[model samples]
Every structure is written in C-alpha cells, then in structure tokens.
Target: MKNSRFSEAQIMSILKQAEGGAPVSELCREHGMSSASFYKWRAKYGGMDASLISEMKDLAE
Candidate 1:
C-alpha cells in the first residue's frame, strides 16, 4: 500500500469540513492538496470516521 502524505485522521477531518459546508476548492487550496486528491479521499473515506478507517486499514493489511 502506498503511504499517504496526510494521515487517515487528517483526511477524515478534512472530509468533515467539506461535510460541514466548506467549499472543496477552498479547502483544497487552504490545505495545499489538489482537488483530485481531496475527491479521491472523499470517495474512499467519505462517510468513515477515524476508528473506522483504522479498522479498514487493519483489514486491508
């Protein structure tokens, strides 16, 4: 598996910001991440919390 620049928790928090009505473009800009990466993370980790992400990672491993 490839290592991500941002941790799962950070990804989840960024997703939460999007969920809470933050604009994706602005979030991406502020976070210095590309829109592609943000959407990719959202697609994979959209509704997942940190613990759930850890569980999924464990299962994948």
Candidate 2:
C-alpha cells in the first residue's frame, strides 16, 4: 500500500475539526487534501484516538 502524506494523528485532528463544525471544503483547501481522502480517513479511523491507532499498529506488526 502507498504511504499517506498525513500522519494518523494529523488525520484524526482533521476529522475532529470536521466534527467540531468546520466545513469539509475549507478543511480540504487548508490542508491540501481531497475531500475523498478526508472521508476515507473518517471511514477508517473515525472514532479512534492516538492510543488506539498505536495499538492497531502494534497488532499489525
């Protein structure tokens, strides 16, 4: 799989911003990412936090 330019933590932060009422288009513009990428991250990591991400990575290893 191709690596993402944004880290998981950064992705989570972006998603949090969305949840906090930021417009999707504005976020995409500010972060230089596509809306598709934001939605994809939401699908994969929507409700997760940093610890969960780290745990998932440890399990993957």
Candidate 3:
C-alpha cells in the first residue's frame, strides 16, 4: 500500500483512474487512501489539469 503523502504525480494518476470510471471505493482500497482524503484531494485539485482548465475556461462564455 502507498503512504499518506503521495506526490503530485501520484495524485494525478489516481485522479485519472477515478476519471476513467474506476470506482472511488476501489481506488481508496487499492491505494490505501481514505474516502475523505480522496474527496479532499479531488476538491482541491479538481480542474487543475492545464488542458482541462483551458477547456473549462473556453466553455465558461
């Protein structure tokens, strides 16, 4: 199991998994993360990806 302080890249990878339709509970179990931690990271880093951010901005009009 991974440790608590996952790096940014790790976070991104998990986020990708979540986005790819891997169940959040599965991610938490496979990665040894708590539901709260996962949700917290999602909220903090949600839409932080450069390409996604640009697309969102373009749609905001």
Candidate 4:
C-alpha cells in the first residue's frame, strides 16, 4: 500500500486540533490537505489514540 506523507501520529494530532475547536477549513489549509481528506481521516481515525494506532500497525505487521 502507498504510504501517506503524514504518519498516523500526525493524522491523530491533526484530528485533535479539530476537536480542540479549530475550524476544519483552517486545519486542512494548514496541513495542506483537503476537507474531504480530513473527513475521511476523521471517519477512520476518530476517537482513536496513538497507542491504538500503533497496536493496529503491529497487528497488521
């Protein structure tokens, strides 16, 4: 699979920014990602912490 420019940790942090009351448009603009991409990430990674992401990676490996 192709890897994204931002890592899972980075994605989580970006999502956190949105949860912290940052506007989705500004977050996307700052991160150079589209609003659609942000929504996709939120759908996939929402409510998940970095440790859970690492665990999922370990399982995939």
Candidate 5:
C-alpha cells in the first residue's frame, strides 16, 4: 500500500476541523489536498483517534 503524505494525527486534525464547521473547500485549499482525499480519509478514519490508528497499524504488522 502507498504511504499517505499526511500522518494519522494530521488526518485526524483535518477531520476535526471539518467537523468543527470549517468549509471542506477551504480546508482542502489550505491543506493543499483535494476534496476527494479528504472524503476518503473521513470514510476510513472518521471517529478514530491517533492511538487507534497506531494500534491498527501495529495489528496490521
């Protein structure tokens, strides 16, 4: 699998920003990522935290 440019913590921060009423378009522009990427991350990581992501990665290994 390809590695992501943003770390899990960064992804979580971005998602939290979106949930905090930040406009998706503005976030995408500010983050230099496309809306699709944001949505994909949301689908995969929504409701998950950094510790959970690390645990998942550890389990995957």
Candidate 6:
C-alpha cells in the first residue's frame, strides 16, 4: 500500500503559506496545487495562526 499521508513538516509548511494569506488562486498557481487541496488542508489543520493567516504572502522574487 502506498502510504499517502502528508508529513507534519509538509503540512506545516503548507499551513504556513496558507497562514500567510496568499491569494487562494495565487497559491494554487504558484504551488501547482488546487483550491480544493488548499481547503482540504485548511479543514484538516484548522489551527494555524489567524493573524498570519490574514497577512500577505512573502513569496520569493
């Protein structure tokens, strides 16, 4: 069986990016992820820092 679970580190990293409040569309485009995946992660790990969750992204130039 392929253990297809996300690691804590991976989840946290995504959570961090999500917490940083990059536009959902932007995140989906930049990370090659989907809005559904983002929402799924958000539902699974719904305790990220709200303040950070509302802040702008710190994406690399």
**Candidate 2: where are CA atoms >4 Å away?**
none
- Runs in model 4 lying further than 4 Å from the true structure: none
Candidate with the larger TM-score of 4 and 6 = 4
Candidate 6 local lDDT, 1-61, one digit each (tens)? 5753555456667768767876778877876767887788778657855344434224311
In model 3, the number of clashes is: 0
Cα deviation in Å at residue 58, candidate 3?
Answer: 25
**lDDT: which is higher, 1 or 5?**
5
- Assess every candidate by TM-score: 0.91, 0.93, 0.71, 0.92, 0.92, 0.56
How would you encode candidate 2's per-residue C-alpha lDDT over 1-61 as one tens digit per residue? 9988999889999999999999999999999999999999999998999999999999999
Candidate with the larger TM-score of 5 and 6: 5
lDDT of 6: 0.66
In model 6, the worst 10-residue window by lDDT is: 52-61
Clashing pairs in 6: 19-53
**Top model number, TM-score:** 2
* Candidate that would win on lDDT: 5
Q: What is the lDDT of residue 23 in candidate 2?
A: 100
Candidate 6: clashing residue pairs, number: 1
Write down the lDDT of every candidate, Cα atoms only. Answer: 0.91, 0.94, 0.82, 0.93, 0.95, 0.66
Candidate 1: lDDT over CA atoms? Answer: 0.91
- Candidate 5, superposed: residue stretches over 4 Å from native: none
After superposition, the stretches of candidate 1 with alpha carbons farther than 4 Å from their true spots are none
